[model samples]
Target chain A: MSQDLVFGLYIFALATFVGYQVISRVPPLLHTPLMSGTNAISGISLVASLVVAGEHHDRFAAVLGFIAVTAASINVVGGFMITDRMLRMFNKKKAPALAKAGS
Target chain B: MRESLINLAYLVASVLFILCLRGLSSPEQGRRGILLGELGMLIAVVATLFKAEIVSFEWIIAGAILGSLIGTAISLKIPMTQMPERIALSHAFGGLATSLVGIAEFHRMRDMADAAATVVAVAASEHALNRLTMGSLGFEVFLGSLTFTGSLMAFGKLQGFITGAPVTWKGQNVMNFAAFAGVIGLLVYQVIFLTAAPQWMFFTMCAVGFSLGVLAVLPIGGADMPVVISLLNSYAGLAACATGFALRSNILIISGALDGSSGLLLSILMSKAMNRSFANVLFGAFGTGGGAAAALPVGQAAKGYNEATVEDAAAVLTASQSVIVVPGYGMAVSQAQHAVRDLATALEKRGTEVKYAIHPVAGRMPGHMNVLLAEANISYDALFDLEMINDDFARTDAVIVVGANDVVNPGAKTDAASPIFGMPVFNVEQARSVIVLKRSMNTGFSGVDNELFYMPNTMMVLGDAKKTLISLFGAVKGDGH
Candidate 1:
């Protein structure tokens, strides 16, 4: 019922709206790059959640914070693993005969 | 409620997550990034479990156990070849869960208000109206719904349940434009209607969201999977962000925003790699194989380059000091990257210097060959890009063309009448000798006979890529005779 709470909620709503609009217009071709790039941002969220939870001495707040941290962490970990795997595919060695046979 | 502990935990977790993401940007440190992310999650989960009011511990436990089991099963069963599809499917699940959570929360609030009014016997419905006033819930519902459906469609396409080509009519762009307009119109209408009476508008919006997801992915082809995958990733992130807003969670918003932006950047890089615009990739009819001009007959080419057996190829390779391997879409189709890797290892043991020459557009997708090679666990330093290895061909004792055609075809650069005239190709002919391994003298995806096949220095090794590579590997290792 507080004015500050209402203002905070409104700001979040605005962010959601703006974020949705921008994301929807994104060309499908830019998906991977965008995903990889935003992956870092997701990291920021994890940090924010952690900080919030640590500050809240209340048991409920702490628990919620932990959950957020866990989920975000999963996203970050899996994302990097997959990205690294993808990049390595680009530099695979060829059979040696290819060099010898061509000569 | 003490806030200091919560803030501190949030800060540490966020810092770790950021560091993890930054590490993932490069191929070398990507694994570290994953570990950091895992650490962040562990911290978040432990922190959240400390909450006091969460009475449904049983449900959370059950959900966590089930989820972990499923995740483990998927990771163990799915091959690296199907990793992209798995990621897409995961995105869909994430979006769906977020949407369901928003719906549940919204309904709970509505029911609570209704119950309070009934118990008090109040004539005013103002409390119930106020409960439904949160715009964050609606936004979450919309974005989550869209991401869920869109990601599913993408998964289906990648899995080959749907055609990979751009599904469009003559005026498809106009239709897409109109559909988008209609979605916006309905969204506005729903918002206005929600202010008064909750009608079928909510369901209608969900339907529109689902349709938008389908429409967004329907135009992309199999060849442009990297871009599509990245875009879907962004949708999932944005959906998460929406969920955060609905829940008034700052962590969610920040993480979601990060995911959304990275997905955008990845798509851009992938598009640039293909030398195409994002718009062109989206609207263009891709994966139309066999549309190129018919290839010239094998017999019509210069007589010296007629097909030879694997034994002959082995002889030349064994006698040669240096070999250059050129791979193409055929190698990918036959899944012969491992065989090629094996053959390379064998040759290297024989004191033969082997180097792989990769063309920019060798396989169906960008980095297709690289992915295959990586799966074979070949060393990174051994693979050479076209520019890096082209000049060295002249000194090569033999050039082994494995399932490669268009990329190494001399006609692409020298022959004016060639359909792929301007496309850059490997200068394989510059090598002192050339050996091509193929099932037949068929042309490539571009549908043109490779003139390099008939060049004086070239000899065709006719057979399946996998079988031929295996035989060649055996032959090279058999006494080096």
Candidate 2:
């Protein structure tokens, strides 16, 4: 394998292990948030799309890149915000009666 | 210097993503995790802008702004009940983006190779697209395309636009397998021949892949959606990993691997919760399969189960010292979570200890029941899992099962003929009195008759769960004696 391919493989393999271990430790109650959180992680591709769309490429390539940038940007921005909104619902209730009940 | 700075920034972003995932392991740190992830994304996007390859920013800025607005609107507009559908739609978008990027990269490099070969010498730069790039890009496009269509199907089912039941015709599996094999054959050819492969070949392969995705998911029943959605999520992650290989981006490699594997883990967990194998969940005929293990005897009238008046249920609840409320998809269908919550609060007023029994696969998605209840403003502390509260059921005064069927069915534990035989169920039968609120004697998602309703300790209260709960609340209030 080429050096670049080998390097990428090494990163991919280790990160897969980390992902499994991290996700497995999460409680069942948080699965939805875990899903949306990782959804945002996949949005990292938005960075590459931005570069591809901005560069002086052929028109066809540029159009493709523009769509990718828009789609990925939506995934990142929407994914994080939605996840944040959901996670807030997971917070402990702060109702005054429940608060003094000594949870 | 600029290159080094970009690499360093990517490295930092990758580290933040790892930390962000770790934070998501607990609910307390979940908000911080999202913020940290946001910061990581911002850093990566800003660093890419400084790479010196970019000549113009107009398209990038315009697309980013427009996309963010739409995304924000979607996230805000979708209700908690519709979260699964919305997530499936987002996965489709992610897969589409990855597939498009792969196609663009392939074409750009192929054109460059063609130009150089014509100007310089025979086969000079024609082979510039190396074997590894060719293979990875081919793999990326295939997975991305499949995920795109598969997730759209999932979205359709969850949104009620399509029938949630598995649509199996004769030779369904055979057709899906053949189409997918064709996509593989084309990918292998492209991988071996590299740039010598025809451009149309790759595009044709992508089209086949999209078809295979739709076929693969169509036969999966709604009961098995958690697994299918999780699998689609994993596919999107794998496509992203391939994209990382194509782009030589470290962040993509790291984050994609994480996203892909985490999705796989969830699928496995979901399958186990349902007490079924991945093959059983994916390929088994499921609800319509001939292996149906319903415990109900044919031609037997409802002889064993007793119909109870709302007053009898009210009497039991008002006098009970300890109660456990089990809410299921029926609760979701009636939008009765708020009513369930109100009932709990009223019971609590009488010093009745009320808690919830949440099965892992209770609603549509994993942790779905929790989200619905959480939206009802129920305190998280009052909820308990099967293991945590199962033992306490026998000593409990009353267990109110609202709109739940199979999860509480004792047949899973005792009936060897049951399709859900090995599935762990809520031990509601062990409680002193079991009050099941049902619209009728209909089976649950598993399409199996619940034996719990007939048990001597159980009483079936018929009607829509929301209306029943409201009536029972009145009865409880007036039961002054």
Candidate 3:
């Protein structure tokens, strides 16, 4: 009923459509990397976690917030790093092949 | 001004994330796309640190540093063959963080409301935590808690720490349904009927969520893991989206939607590849009694198959001018990817053109085979999907099936009564000669007997796939000498 909630719902619906359009085009070759990449991006929850950990509202909340921050940062850091490592392997055979195909 | 800057940063980050996914459509732009995502994450984190509400920095700094160290170690040390397990574990972490944030938010809001009631009118208590926020928080905790345990179960199965067979018992589906209903009932009660938040109800929902996760995934066989992993990825994303509603952060909502849709699409694709609907995979207990019962039929039919040695297989390869290799989860189980690549190289040296035919649902997750092959230093250009290379099988002189069975079975196309009858499979039978490298005559995870193994032109080389491939490679290389 609130204006902000209404706007959030709108964003959620539209972003989902955008996501479908973008993800459907991704080939099966990079699917593993795509999953990990989106996973790392979803760690955007780290933004919320930082506020909870740093707000100093209460000791109990802060402790929970600390763990939340740590867990989310792992996804952010590990997911992206592993994805990059996988993509690097793919690039090895792609560079020359893609060059010839493009020309 | 400060709020505007943070919102602007989130908007920019959303665009970057979208572009990053677009970049993933090809192998050439994949790494650069990941770099864009990393930059977006950095920008979002920096802007959050400048928020006006945050009063302290020590805990945030400490958690981030420790997490980065552990994450880095894991990324650097894990082998590509273990990618499915690693991705499942990462989903668990994502779920854990989302649920913990929801719990903290709920606790803070209750305390703030209590504190406000003493200074202002009694009605002012509701202002701190409204009905909408309560609903989204409940939604967040439910999905986040379930995804946490579900992913861990998937990880355990993939890592071989737990049995990969479908574990079922009497009335398993009924019990799962009850637990799922309980969570929804609790969520509906607290969010809609009560003015005050009850701690017991919320935590009870959390417990039920965890139980539902374990029960739901318990009956799914190892072969159905690609769908399970993708579905969990979707749950983790939806949890984050609900968290965004609780916190009113647009970036969280946008990224969560992207992640959620990506998982949903992949699950659909994976399910289609196996010719099974989502409901069948979730509740059919697909390979439960079928595996043991199916083994008996295979035992009777085994007498008709032709078993060959490495020398015969090497001779077959030597005569062929073109070869296609089909890989499956068996390859991953035996860790034979490097050996596969070596054999292909030897075949290539003798003027045999070798290419890989990758099924969409091969291995434990989507794109599982591609990553393993890439790690083995095989050119991505040599790998073809079912659509690209299915027709080429007829023209090829030989087809080598390494640790793969069901994907190439002719039963999928010819037998209507077969469980996997509608699934698309490679036409290995159409090739001039077929060489199958398997450890034993055991049926695949689906528990179906493969007719391809009994075909006259098909030669079954029984042994450890890696050892067989190594021997075959040696024979081919020796011919050159």
Candidate 4:
């Protein structure tokens, strides 16, 4: 493989390992929030989409990039907001602190 | 300098996202986790605007504003019960976006190839329909197109727009596999031939991929929705990763890998928790009672069970010193968590300790029951997982199984011939006195009859969970100490 391909694969492999380690420890009750949180993280693509749409000044590329930016933005904003809402409810309970104490 | 700045900012954003996952897994740290995730997204979005080529911002700004407004409205208005469907819809959008960009990029590159045909370096270069890029595009479009339809199918099933049961027909699996294989076949052909292949071939692959997505999910019963959701989640991440490859974007690659791997892990963990294989979950055509082992003779259904009145169930509850409530999808369907909570409160006032027994696959999604209970303001301490609280069932005075069937079904443990056999289930039958609140003697999604219902210690309170629990609440409170 070429140098750039090797670099990309290395990043991909290491990221997967890190992700697996991080998520394995999560409590089941946090599954929903974890999902939504990651949903927001996936929205990171909105940035590249914005650059692709604006950087080239090409008509069609701009259109595709705009739509991608829109979709990713929705995922980011709605995902994080809903997660925040759910996490708020979870935090409202004194039970979280107490439950973890026993574990 | 500019490229390095962008890369550095992306690195920072990646770190924040990592922290988000780390903190999000714990209930107590959930809020900070979301905050970090949001901050990371903000930094990444802002940094992207500084890329040297972006001369115009009108369309970008417009799209963001419109998307944000719609997204905010959805987040604000969607009921928490519908969150899973909402998530499925989000997956659909993300998948669509990625595929659209991939197609656009390929078409643009093809146009360049045509324009530069006379330039020997351009025409003869590996990039004359670059094999690496085409391979990634093939991977990206195949997954993205399928994930788009699969998630929409899931949303339809969850939202009541489609038949909630497993939709299986003759040779559905064979057909699904064929469709998927066709997409892969075309994708491979496209990779080998690059732009030499006709453009219609790629779009045709997308068409078949879409159909494959729908058929793949149709055979899956609604009961296994948690697995399906997480599996689709993994698919969405893989699609994103493939797009990252096609685009050569660092943030997309890192975050997509993170999302993809975590989703797969969650799916595997859920499958393990339920004591089923991923293959079993995918092709088992599970949750349809029509499976081979569940051939209950017509009119023989009521022979093994007896129903009890609300007072008899209440008397058992009133006499109990400790009660463990095991909830399932029926509670969510009937919206009985609040009534159940009221019943628990009344039971507690009567000097009984009440805790919930949450089987990992209790509802349509993992942690679905927790979300319902939390929405009703039930204390988190009152909820206990199967592992943490399964042993407590034997010593408890009573288990008020609220509309839960499969999770509490003893068949998972006892009947080797049963569809749910070998699947982990709550040992509700082991409790001293089992008080079951269900509408009737219906089998759960696994298509197996619950032997727990027939056990002598079990008392079936046949009615709607909310109505029954509400009455039980009244009956227990009306009986003076």
Candidate 5:
């Protein structure tokens, strides 16, 4: 394998471990937000889509890139917003004091 | 310098995403985590805009603006009760974007090979498709296509646009298997014989992957949607990872892995909560043919059961000191979270301690009940998971199961013959008194009879759960005492 591919595999392996560690510790109460949050971050594919849309490729590739960008943008924008909305609602009865205590 | 800056932004974004999940480990800091994630996304997008290769900006700008408008509207308008459908649709969007990117990359690679071949007067076959890039592209397109259609199917079921029952036919499993195998075969063929593969082979793989998605989700009953949705979440992430490989982007790989692992772990937890294997959930057609047995349990046939009126339930609630509410998918169907909150409030007014017990597989997705209850303004701190509150049921004054059945069923513990036998359930049977709010005497989505419903101490209040909760709310607060 090329060094670049090997490097990516290293990143993938280590990130997967870190993801499991972080995500597994998340309380079930926050699971819905977790799913949506990771989803929004997965829109990192937007970077690649950006290249495809503006790389001066053929019109056909550009069309595909345009649609891809639109879809990914929705996941990023909507996913994060909805996740934030949901997370904001998860509060202790004594919102100010108890939030600090609980954390 | 610009390339290094882009890479630096991505590295920072990766760390922010990690911290975002870390923040989700508690509810108190969850919103802050989401804010951090949004900032990371903003930075990554802005940096990508500075990439040297991007010569045109019109399409990107237009698509981003239009998408932002639609996304903001959706996020603002969607009620918490529709969270499952909202989540499912987002998965679909993620899938669509990843697959389209994969297709575009493949197109570019092919064009590059064609140009090189023309210059050298050689065949494109020998020049096209290095093993690693081709492998990643093939996997990306296949997984992305499947996730797109699979999530759409899940959304339809959760939204009631399609039947929640498992849709099965003769040889359904076999057909699904064949289609899945065919797609994998095409992918393998492309990877192994990279030189001789036709473009149509790749498109055919995409087509088969799309159909396989529908077939895979078709036989999964609504009761198992938590697992299905989680699995789709994982698939969407993996597709993104594959896109990263094809593009040699480290940031994409990192975020994709995080998302993929998160989804996979949730799927595993959900499946474990229901005591089912991944294979069983995917192909078991669990609720099929079980409905016939479920229909056998009707009103008043079982002598130990008490059919209580709204007055009796209200009186019971009013008399109780501590009450625990167990919500199920039924609560979501009837949109009873607000009513439930109101009842809890009334009970609290009377000095009755009210807490919510949430089973892992209680609703359409993981944390489904928590989100709905939170939207109803109930404190997350007041909600307890099965393990935390299962032992407390014995000490509670009364237990109210609203629009929930299977999770509280005692059958899961004592009856080995039961389909849900190995699953952990609430010990509501150990409470002082139990009131179950259900529509008619129908068994839950699993079609298994709940022995708890037939116990002497349990009272079945048959009606719409929302209406019943509302009436109970009135009776408790009416001051006839």
Candidate 6:
């Protein structure tokens, strides 16, 4: 019934629709790069949630915000760390030879 | 009131989520992106709990405690080898959470009128319109539920708990299409009868969606796991976005959207690496029993292949001016990457130019050989691709192959009747001398014996890859060559 509530809901809906549109068109070829990229975005979410929790006067909202903050933080940090470890495998050294043609 | 501050925090969190996504595109700056995401969620959660109107904290506290314990346990227990499975499982959890959120939001909306008599007059006007309005809650529930089941199936398949074969019949595609049609039909019905015939229709749609997940993943084999994992990850993100929409949370919407798009792109990349179409991966029985049944008969005259001892192998390497090493899955299975790297170092010290030649698909997984070498801290410059080093093989004094079978088969390029013919291969036989380390003359995953073994320049160092490499390194060191 409130104008603020209505506006908030509209923003959420618009973001969701736009987000899905962007997601569906993403070519599977770009998955890992995109995942690592989006993980950084998840990190930003964690920061914003923390700041929001700090600024909030309502104890309940702040606590809920904190929980979300923690979850997203773990997702972003651990996700990237694992991704880096995975990427390191793309570089390896060559093997050695066994015998000569005429010994 | 303080709502303004909470709203401001929400806006900021949304912006950070956007930035975090952008940063993750590059390997160099990915860590920063992760940090930004952490900050955003922290802000969002803090702001949400600041709501003054909400009085109860017990439920939230209990939920947080339980979630943290489970999360921590999963995080600590999972091994690096099973990281892909763990990632899929995390996506499943995200999907499950979104689905639950959607259900709770729907229930809350339904009970709103009855619980608060203060808004009865306003409720009557909204109630009449609500009956005709399509609630986001239903959409979120549908998508989230699908994501939850789909991700679980992907995880199971990746973990080897479930078969990675597509369980399809002659009319499987038709059935899948019908399922899609059924979901759409159920969705339309739900929109019209928002409050009526809830249980049966809801359950039916869920079942169809779940079956669709199984159908979508069943056709893909284990070899195409990376693509499947990424695809399921995208589904999980979309589910989260749907939940955000239902709950009217901007932060969730933005973050989920970023995750969803990234997942889709990763899937595309993985598909390209296999040189297969996305549809083929989804429906074709690729890398299944195709390579498992055919066993190439080994040549009885194995005289030329395993004719060299460690000292003989040492003699060849000792005279070489240049040596190029080629490693394969056998290297990984034998845990010989480090040993091979050490041998290369010793060869270089003996005034022999040593370089590593790598094939694109040399190991079990993409970049498997590369990872093994990197773990040994091998210089990045010493590693060369097949195209780059193939020509040099002929000029090199020796080509030492460790625990490799298929990649160096020579049959792939030389034998027209060979099953893997036309597949690109490393020209290991071109080198002046070739030494192969192996425990037996067993054919590789392609189930074909390597023709390179018969080459005059090639000699098999029969033993484990690690042991052979170590012995060869020791011999080279002792010879003082």
Q: List per-prediction Cα lDDT, in the order shown.
A: 0.62, 0.84, 0.89, 0.80, 0.89, 0.61
What TM-score does each prediction get for chain A alone?
Answer: 0.52, 0.85, 0.86, 0.84, 0.88, 0.53
Compared with the true structure, what per-residue lDDT tens digits does model 1 show for residues B40-115? 6567656665655344354454445544555555545665546556667666655665555555555544555566
After superposition, the stretches of candidate 1 with alpha carbons farther than 4 Å from their true spots are A1-103, B1-4, B25-29, B51-53, B105-143, B190-194, B197-199, B289-308, B319-321, B324-333, B357-371, B384-463, B479-481
B1-481 per-residue lDDT for model 4 (tens digits)? 9978987998999999999999976778878877888888888888888888678898789879978987899999987777788888888777776766676677667766665665764455356467767877777777877888998999999988988778878887788887777777887888777767788988887777678788888888888888888887888788788777777777788898988987798788789877889998899887654746357534447576758999998988999888999998889889898898788777766667778888888878778888888877787777888889988878888998987888887877878877777888888887899988888776666666778888889888898889999999999989875
Docking class of 5: medium
The interface root-mean-square deviation of each model, in the order shown, is 8.1, 2.0, 3.3, 3.7, 3.4, 7.8
The sequence of per-residue lDDT tens digits that candidate 2 reaches over residues B337-389 is 88888777777666678889998877777777887888888877778887898
Candidate 6 regions with alpha-carbon error over 4 angstroms: A1-103, B1-4, B18-30, B52-55, B62-79, B111-143, B163-170, B290-344, B347-481
Whose DockQ is greatest here? 2
Q: What is the DockQ of candidate 3?
A: 0.56
Backbone collision tally, model 6: 73
Ranking by TM-score: 3, 5, 2, 4, 1, 6
CAPRI class assigned to model 6: incorrect
Per-residue alpha-carbon lDDT of model 5 for A35-96, expressed as tens digits?
88998999888888899999978999899989989999998999999998998887777533
The whole-model C-alpha lDDT of candidate 1 against the native structure comes to: 0.62
Structure candidate 4, residue pairs in collision: A55-B53, B287-B445
Task: Specify the highest-TM-score model's number.
Answer: 3
Lowest-sum lDDT 10-residue window in model 1 chain B: B123-132
The digit string of per-residue lDDT tens for model 6 on B63-152 reads 445555655565556543344566666665555555554444444444453344356655453463253233455555666567667778
Q: RMSD of each candidate?
A: 7.7, 2.4, 2.6, 3.1, 3.0, 7.4
* Candidate 3: pairs in clash: none
